[model samples]
Target: MTVDNLPLIELPIIDFGPYLDPSSTAEQRQAVDHAIDKACRHLGIFYLVNHGIPQELCDKMSVIARQFFSLPFEEKRKHKVGGEVRGYWFTTNAEDLSNIPCEGIAFHPPVNQCSNGVAPDIDPASPEARLPTTHDALGGQHSWPNDHFRAHAEELLSHIVPLKVRLLDSISNCLGLSDASRKLVQNTVPHIAFNSYSSLTKAQMEEGVSNLVEHTDPGTITILTQDVDVVALQVKDSDGKWCGVKPIPGSFVVNVGSSLNRFTGNQYVDTLHRVIHCSEKSRISMALLADPVFDVVIEPLPECPFKTDLAKFVPKTFGAFYLDQVPEDH
Candidate 1:
């Protein structure tokens, strides 16, 4: 269905430019507050603009993504999961094949060790099981055809990670939590996966052969950067009907995930969304998942009063719940 035909809700668009000013204007703070309220009350989704990230950087990242995914299957396979930490992955390979409920392993441990005397867990037998890969170096040493892209990817990561923290803090203030409560999530390391949806032809879109399946992101927040003209992303509304989201240039789609739901005591919405192929032209988008570190404890903000069962509302570590949801290969 077209974006207009479905029962989809429009989220807010927050501009961070004014907030970045040294002498912040009254209107700026009000704008931020308005955006915060919209995110908390309505769908926990919004389009971010003037976020300080350069257009050149965004363009370059998109180029790298398209180039990497366009590599020959054999070439792309060279970057496969030789170890758990970094590499490339094919579509659908991220599915957990051992959990009863069935889910995908979207988070990967940081490449470095944490300060709490905790070592990042590594799986020798199944490197693929540890995290999503981009290249296919199954049994070989991991390598990249273009090393320059690695630098760009890391740069993007550096900027985005901190931005996520700032956004989380805004969320905390909206909930009226103290600074200490906000810092509770400061050390929460995010496992990011840079995803690119390939441009599919009409036949492929009609056949539904290449698009992602219906599922909710399993993290605190999922930020996406998609092509401007493509029209294939869809979200299921409260009425159980699929609605399309129109592409707004220089705009990114943010969806609240399960982790955020737990952290906020269910004040935000973590709705179901998926991508469908369009016959008009090919499409590409980058999806970054920001999740808490595996060991960090998740609990509802104490200030949020709710009549619902506290046990149900209390948060749980993502790793504990994510591991249990791994699906089995039939």
Candidate 2:
């Protein structure tokens, strides 16, 4: 079938059951590869099924997220800038300023090292003590009221971090890397965020005022779990048409980010994407941004680099590149 006639629903939903099975047959591996190729090509998006994250847990997380966002503005503000690692952010607090119009890209800058104001009791050397900065704005202390939210947020991280590692391995395999070469991702430090967009009025939706402007994610990989009925996410198709991505119940969307594009020497495409504010309902989403550890070197893969002139390309450490592009606080 022609690309247009093939299916209105062209996005791929990949099943991970085969990868988890000890006795998985060769055909199963081939099937997985096929899915990965298609997802990386036609649309830089995919639905992951059988990923082992419990449906009940996802539902509970969603409910709690809704509750958290529903709190009075003042109560929610208790977790605002300048406290510990957990809190809330208002609309327009974090954004990317580099885009000429800053239309679709919501860039959140990194927390500045000096002003983070982390508690004295929490040692900086501790792995768990680092905080995700407020969206590309000022990096000061996170203002969380108590320990309850902190504990739950940590629990969610515990569940998803390893899954992210495994998925990265699968991605590495798709690039024909050896098992040991998967080490390319080992030292990566990933950031995760739970964000809820306030419901927009019909007029706001029509004007695209509450919608996220188009931009590509800057990290290596991004995995997102979104509200089932919310239909605001959209990606540019090969034909440059805007296509809506409907959330699949019990699945997450995975997309490659800019870092991965550089690592693959641009062999794999990292497509542009954005979100529209829901007109009929508010939307909640959990986003995970995974990148190599600060010290890990990011160079183009050997095979892919030779095809393009390596001499003209610029090389910068992953951390340096990310910090440079952090969205300026509005």
Candidate 3:
């Protein structure tokens, strides 16, 4: 169910150029902060412009993603996930995502700790029970493509990690958070993903199959961009109606996720978004998501920018809570 009324059309398009400029005035920074705060509380999403990511890098990542996904099914299958959902795998037609077949990979930073148990209120049968690999090795290492395109693909993550740092810091300032609360965000090791959505016929689109099922991100924040000329992003408004969002050239779609929703005392809404069937062309997009080191506690701070009643936070550990939200297929 949705809890907001602001339409996606009127979404705030925030410019980051000013914030990054060395000579930017305090007033300009404050304006940016206000924009972030408003969008998160009202719509839970916003478009980010002038984020300083080179256009060439974005284009290169898209090209490499399309190239990799275009490989023969057998070739891609060689890199498939065995048990952990970290490498390349085919996305089957589930009931919710019918007609939209896709595949993607998730890459987490070096992590060795097995997931800590969930909060006392969680169920034993939950996905949270699926612990990560332990023993000092980073869990779920991604299987890089076997082709020359691998370098370009890997470089995408390099650019994305630093971008996430800038984003989280800005978000911290926007929330007027104390250093203690900000630590939850700063401790997050970025996770990068490359997704390729396959083309769908008109008939399949009419049959109600979307490129993805509606869901909210489990991480703290998500920064994503679609390939030029590809569109079909839809977000559920507070009225619970799906609204399409067209691509804005060279801009990124940013959304607060459920993790931040919890820690922010529900001040920042975790938005539900989806991609729909697009005729002819397959769509490629990449996302950089962030969550604190698995064991960090996510409790609402005493000071929050949005008007929220702090009574709702359940005080769950980041890793345990994120595992619980993983889709069964993953």
**Which candidate's lDDT is highest?**
3
Q: How close is candidate 2 to the true structure, as a TM-score?
A: 0.76
- Most accurate candidate by TM-score: 3
- Per residue, candidate 2 scores C-alpha lDDT tens digits across 142-221 of 44334665566557667777778777767776677754456764445556676666545555545555456677876778
**What does candidate 3 score on TM?**
0.84
Model 3 spans > 4 angstroms off: 1-8, 94-100, 114-139, 147-150, 305-312, 328-330
Clashing pairs in 3: 4-238
TM-scores for all candidates: the values are 0.76, 0.76, 0.84
Report the C-alpha lDDT of model 1 over 199-249, residue by residue, as the tens digit: 444544455443566777667787777777756778766567777777777
Candidate 3 per-residue C-alpha lDDT over 136-254 given as tens digits, one digit per residue, 9 for 90 to 100: 23334567776555677567767767767877777889877788888866767677788878776566666766667789988788889887675567887778777767679989999
Ordered list by lDDT, greatest first: 3, 2, 1
Instruction: List lDDT for all candidates, in order.
Output: 0.60, 0.62, 0.72
